[model samples]
Every structure is written in C-alpha cells, then in structure tokens.
Target: MSAWLFDLGNTRLKCAPLREDGAPGEAVALPHRREDAAAALAQVLPARFEVAYLASVADPALRLAVLEALGARCRRIAIARTQARFGALRVAYAQPRRLGVDRFLALLAAHARGGAALVCGVGTALTVDLLDGDGLHRGGRIAPSPATMREALHARAPQLPDTGGAYREFAADTDDALASGCEGAALALIERSRAAATELLGRAPPLLLHGGGAAALAAHLPDAIEIPGLVLDGLARWAAVERAAGG
Candidate 1:
C-alpha cells in the first residue's frame, strides 16, 4: 500500500506519495485554501490511497476541509504532538500540544537521517530547529521571512518601492537597497540561530535548508546544506511510525 503525505503550511499546501519501499513519487503544491486544496486533490487523486497523513500549520477550517475531502478513501492520520523517540533526539517542547506538528515532524525526519542537523524551513516564516548528534531537539527560533520583510515594509511605508531584483550582498542603489536590506535581515537572523545551535551542539550542525524562500536566501547561506521537500520527507517518516503503532 502507498502512503500519502500532506504538509498544510501557512502559504501553500504540498502533497506527495511514498511507495511501500520508501521511495518518494510525484509531488504537488497548491495555494493554502480549501477550494484550491479540494480542486488540486480532485485533479490529482482519483483512486483511494492506503494511508494518508497530514501536517497542518494553517487555519482549522481549512484543515477540516482537507480532512473532509480525503473522506473515507484512505485511513486518515493527523500528526499530533506525541512522545517520539528517533535515535537520541528527545522532543522537549514545553507544551507538546502547542508545538507545530510540521516542525516536530521535520526535526524527527532530520534526526532519522542521522548526525547533528540544523533543520531550517524558509517559507511564509523562517524557522531554525536544532537537533544534536545524539538526536536531541534542543530548541529552535522563528523569524519573518525575507519576502515578508519586503512586503511588510512596502505595505506599511508608502515611500518604499517594490524593487523586483534578486537579493544581493551589496546594493548598488535604492532599488537594490530594499532587497538587500530585507534579505540581509533574514540572513542575519538565520545565521544567528545557526551560531547558537552550533554553540549548543559543539559543532556546526549540518544545515538543511528547505521551503519557498530557500532559493532567495541561498546566496546568503554559503556554508549551509540545502534540501528541498523536507516537510514531505518528515511526513513520510511520521507515517512509518504511525503505521508501526497501528494508528
């Protein structure tokens, strides 16, 4: 039986299927809306799946809509904050129930890959999660995304113009100025979090950069390891554990 994984994030929804052997198949992304999710699923999934897992960080209404759409076609499994032991990584959330399931799953997935890792997800917001070599989820941080900074500035201040240029290390003029500033701010925040994680872990954890804003910040993060589909990877791992537990 195949396993279907859904990552319901703030800005977008992503879905992918993992074959029985753990190989990822096709993946798709849609806007984070009930109508869009329903339409996308209708277009892509015609047959019933074996197991379905969801990691949502969006509105509860939209999340329910997704669950309703999936219906009785598959065994639906919503990821929750549970005591998960993957290697040596101990989930230490103050209130596991309050923690983002997607973040937790992503950290678990990175731990499954072995060794210390800094799992960074750059989407509507940027998140940096630290996992030690012993597989302990020490902690993480969240900050505004590069695009959000630029957009927010444009929205709040009438004087700031929207400059459609790639983020660079140095801005030649005003247009590039906004781009560089916003991008630099995001980079600095991420780097600071990385440094903190390094200090805690005693070595620079292998960085795993993922999400929409990853490409924009790629130039800024020279030494970090970049990996796409981290959420999908995490969902897949979570599905395996859920299956073993007969959920």
Candidate 2:
C-alpha cells in the first residue's frame, strides 16, 4: 500500500511517498503564502494513500488546510508531535511542545541512524540540536535563518534589496557582505555548537544538516552530512512503531 509523508514549513509544504524500506521518495514541493496557504495543498495533492503522516511548523490555519487535504484521500492521518521521550531520543525540553516538532523529529531520525549527532536544520529558521550517542538530547539553539536575516535586513533598510547576494570570505560589495554575513552567522553558530557538543560528549559527533537551506550551509561546513526529509524519516519510524503497538 502507498503511504505519504508531509512536512509543512513556513515557506513550503513538502510531500512524498514512503518506500518499502521506509525512506521518503521523490518530493513534491509547493510554495505556501501567508495570504492564502490552504490553496497550495488543495491544488498539489490528489492521490489517495493508505496513510499520511505529518510534521508541521506552519501557522495553525495552514496546518489545518494541509491536514484537511490529506484527510480527503488518506485512510489514516497522523500528525507527529514533540514528545519528551521517543525511542533512543530524550528531549531536553521540560515541556516538549515548546520545542519544534521538526527539531524533535530530526533528533529522532538522527538517533535512529545510530551514534551521536549534531542535527542542524536551516530553513525558515536555523535550529541546532545535539544528541549524545546514548540518546540523550543535549539541548539546542535557534536563530534567524540566513534567509530570515536577509529579509530582516531588508525590512529594516528598504534600500538593501533582499534579492542579490553571494557568499564570500571578504565581500567587496554590499550584496556579498549581506550574503556572507548572514550565512557566516549561521555557520559560526553551528561550529560553536559542534565544539560544545564535542566537549560535552568527550568526542566530536557527526554533524547532520537538513532543510531547504542545508545545501548552502553544507557548502561551508564540509564535514556536515546533508540529509533531506529527515522529519519524514522520523514520522515513518513513529508510524511503524504505532503499527506494531496496534498489532
């Protein structure tokens, strides 16, 4: 039977099928607008699936729209949430929901892959969460993503056009400066967190990068392993566990 995995973010809604091995297949991305987000999901999704699992950090209204669309064709729809504990991963948050579902899922997926990992998600926001080899979440940090930073800069100074920029070590132009500065900020944070994780864990953990902005960040963090659709992987794992429990 076919099943679907959907990751709803601030700017995009990514949907994909689950392969037999429980990996996400080709992804279909649809832009989500603040003015009218529901239309995007209703327009892009059509096929019926045995089940649909989701992890969302979008507005509640937008989330509802996506779920409604999935409800139309999916026999079962499960919305993944941030739990205090799951499998080998234990959230550091005393109140799990305070932590984004996407972050929790990424940590779960990382733990499932085995070994200690520093999972960094660069998307609407840049989030870094550290998980020890023993499955204990070692806390995390969040900051405005490069894109968000750029947008903020533009908003604050309308003269700085948000569109043009290139990353460089020593930017000679305003565009390059903006690009490098924002990206560098994210990179610096990731590096600092990695260093902290290394000290706390007594060794350096593997760095796992994901989300829309991951590729750009990976270019700078050469050792970082880029993994797409990490949230979906965790959703699949959760679904499998739920199925086993029901049986």
Candidate 3:
C-alpha cells in the first residue's frame, strides 16, 4: 500500500511519499494560504494513497481545509500529536498538548539519533529544544525568527525593507544593519541556549537546525547539522511505531 506524509505549518505545507522502508521521499512544498492551498496540493498529490500521516501547526480552518482535501485521496489519515512519552523520549512540557507537535517531533527525531542535541527550528518563529543523550527533554525557548523580526519592523516602519542585505558585526547601511540586527539576535539566542545546554549536560551537544529559514543561520553555525525534512522524518518514525503496535 502506498502512503504519504504531510507537514502543515503556519506558512506552508510540505508533502512527501512514504517509502516501504518507512522514510519520506522527495518533498514538495506549497504556501498554505486559503486561496492557493487546494490548487497547490492537487498538483503534487498522487491519484490515490493508502494512508496519509499528518502533523499540522496551522490554524484550525487551514488544517480542516487540508484535511478535507486529503480525505478525498487518502484511505486513512493519521494525525501526529505531542505526547508525554514516545518510547524512551519523555516530553518536558507540563502539558504535552501545549508543545507544538513540530517541536516535539523534532525532539523525537533527534533522540532517535542517540545523542545529546540542541534542536533549533527556524521558521515562522525560532524554536530551540534541548534533549539529553538518554532521550530526556530539557525544555526550550521560542522567539520571533529573523524573518518575522524583519517583517514586523518593516510593518512598523515603511522605509525599512523586509528582505535583503547581509549580516555583519557592524553594518554601514540600513539594509545591512537591519539584517545584522535581526539575524544576530536569533544567532545570539541559539548560542546562549547551546551554552546553557552544555553547562547543564556537562558536555556540548551537537546542534541540529531545520525549517525554512535555517539556511540563513546555518551559514554562520559551521557545526550545525541541517535536516530539511526533520518534521516529516519524525512523523515517519511515529507512523512506523504506530503501525507496528497496530494503532
């Protein structure tokens, strides 16, 4: 039976074929805006799928619209949710539901690699999560991502451009300064989180970066591992575990 994975975020929706080996195939992304979603998905989805596994952090209306579209082409749909525990991985959130499933799934993917890690998601928002070698969640932080920062600044000041320019310690122009300030703020938080995680774990954990805007920061963090399909990867793991247990 053929299956697929769908990761729906605030800005876009990413879908991929689920291979027999239980990994996501080549991914295709589409903006989740109400007007564009249906047409975009239609162009990418296969004629039919035996199953569809989804993890969504988009608003209810958007999710429902996507679900409606998927239901027409998929035999069964499995939604990914944040849980207190998934095998050995324990969630740090007092209320698991409150933790975005994307972040939780990212932790699951990191834990499955069998090591301590500082997982960072750079998308609509910058999210940092810490996981120990033993698969224990160590909490995390969230802040407006550099892109969001730029957009917000531009919204308030019409003269400020929302995009472009380069990052520098001290920029000579407004565009460069805006870029440096926003990107630098995000980089600073990641560095701080990494330092704290190191102190708490007594060893520096490897950094894992994912999401749409990760490239912006990845250039600066030489050691950071980039996993473009992180959320889908985690969803794949969840799907495998569930299937094995006959869920």
Cα TM-score of candidate 2? 0.94
TM-score of each: 0.90, 0.94, 0.98
Cα error, candidate 3, residue 51 (Å):
1.0
Cα RMSD for predicted model 3: 0.8
Off by over 4 Å in 1: 72-77, 80-87, 158-163
lDDT of 1 by residue, 1-247 (tens): 7677788888888888777677456788877577666666776675787667888888988888888787756766556554555546587686665667777877877887889898888888888888887778887888888777777888998688755766667878776888888888878888888788878767888888888778878766788777678878877776776778888
lDDT of each: 0.77, 0.86, 0.93
Backbone clash pairs for candidate 1 read 88-135, 89-135, 89-136
Q: How many residue pairs clash in each candidate?
A: 3, 0, 0
Pick out the ten consecutive residues of candidate 1 with the lowest summed lDDT: 78-87
lDDT of 2 by residue, 28-106 (tens): 8888765455566666556666888888999988788777777878798877889998876899999999999999888
- Which residue runs does candidate 3 get wrong by more than 4 Å? none
Better of 2 and 3 by lDDT: 3
Better of 2 and 3 by TM-score: 3
